[model samples]
Target: MKTCILTTDTYLNHDTGQGHPERANRVTVIIDHLKKLKSKDLIWKKPTKFDLEYLAFAHDKNYLDNVKDSFPKQGLNFLDGDTIVSPGSKEATRDAVGSILTAIDGVMKKDFNNAFCAVRPPGHHAEKQKAMGFCVYNNIAVGAYYLLEKYNLKKVAIIDFDVHHGNGTQDIFYDNEKVLYISTHQYPYYPGTGKNSEKGKYNNVLNIPLPAGTTSEEYLDAYEYVLKKLKEFKPEFILFSAGFDAHEDDPLAQLKLKSEDFYNLTKRTIRAAQLSSKGKVVSILEGGYDLNALKESAEMHVNALLEF
Candidate 1:
């Protein structure tokens, strides 16, 4: 089996205005870099149309209706202060969500060992009913639900290594005992929801909050806890809310992670979960601002996926 890369040109239409950290070029850099690999071990695919009911599994029906009506015909509409959508966002948002679903199906059916979804507006910030932090829909959360409902898997683990906390993911799975949501992020930072004490209602959520200027060694050291939790959960399938904003060059956050650290993080996590997950892994883009850093970090992340 090979590693699949899921993406679509619709992302180019999700304009966030004149200047925003979550821009189209983020995916462009990653796709361009991955194309340069030209490795037969890498499989490139586009997101397919999925049932809309899956979105309702992770979000409120009214919220879904609101989002469907929010797309503007000519200008951009704001879902929140930072989360905006343009006319093309109607298709782009659906594609972003669909990308994860397509990746999940590919991995589940053994069409691929794993997949990476290069998409935007990045998810993990959008809650069940509200959109925030440049996210309109919680893509990983939707994928988790897809596994639980469609495939009837009981234990699924979502490892979010983004620089900022995944408040929306935690919110959706806070009470669900079947899913374990773990996050490592900068503390006292944007969105401000990832405290160590903020465990889920069922104690299935683990939050490791690191302060700003955390070194690569420090971040990797803390990641041991993430592996420990994943080992304990023994998930049947693993999903990574892959975020590269922790890189030192990322302008949006203050973690000193080097590009290579992503490879270690991914390789170690897969090894820890291999026994139970059986190499069934899927990752979706969350956050990473700097183009150069995003490109480098995503490449390292994929390298581990390819070699695994």
Candidate 2:
């Protein structure tokens, strides 16, 4: 299998100051561990510069201009209470969006079978007009639009396994019939949006809200519902909002998933979507705080991607 890892060092400069869970070290640790693998099967690539018009596809024009003006020279600027940006964040945020777009191009051109983007300043929480939950431009959302507009793909499915609900991704595609957004996240949690009833306008959104202490068995059981939904949609392309914070070791969430569970989750998803998608899938980093668990869980997810 041709598997690529898309990333860049600009993430290291996206400083969030001291003690922030979404710090630069998060991606650093995962990249470091991945380097230890040193497998010839893995191709490392950097995010390519993309047209800013793609940003307008996922975010409001005014909001895009505001984000452009929000980057501070010396200090950090906060888009929301938690979403912080510094001088280097300008490039970091763009790269975050670029990472997914680049990976999509590589997959579409058959340069790689699939890819995992390990970029930072994680997106999935940024709505069309606002940033929240440490997310800026909703990178995956733009990638979905890229598939829709560039490849003219009619059906695109975004499966979010992040610990927190992808409130922004749902917000962006709630009314679009071409895309299906399904997420299994901890509910009654921060941002507090993912109710089982918040289906999209086209019924394209499926939010499976788990309790605070959901176990692996329970979570996987719920994931079966996600698989069922994917089977029905028969998407031509799939994007994973891959977050590892659901692990028991993560400090941010209460879910009790082990590292190996990610492998099972990813494998199940791939098998379910392969026939319709022709094995075209791209995954990007979202939320995973605990360094050790994040590293292990990411590797497991990639392992499945490779084997499948």
lDDT of each: 0.95, 0.95
Q: Which stretches of candidate 2 lie over 4 Å from their true place?
A: none
C-alpha TM-scores of all predictions: 0.99, 0.99
In model 2, state the lDDT of residue 181: 99
Residue-level lDDT for 87 in candidate 2: 96
lDDT of 1 at 178: 95
Looking at candidate 2, the ten consecutive residues that score lowest on lDDT are 299-308
Per-residue lDDT of model 2, residues 54-115, tens digit only: 99999999999999999999998989889999999999999999999999999999999999
TM-score computed on alpha carbons, candidate 1: 0.99
How do the residues 149-260 of candidate 1 rate in per-residue lDDT, one tens digit apiece? 9999999999999999999999999999999999999999989899999888888999999999999999999999999999999999999999999999999999999999
- Residue 290 of model 2 has an lDDT of 94
Clashes of 2: 0
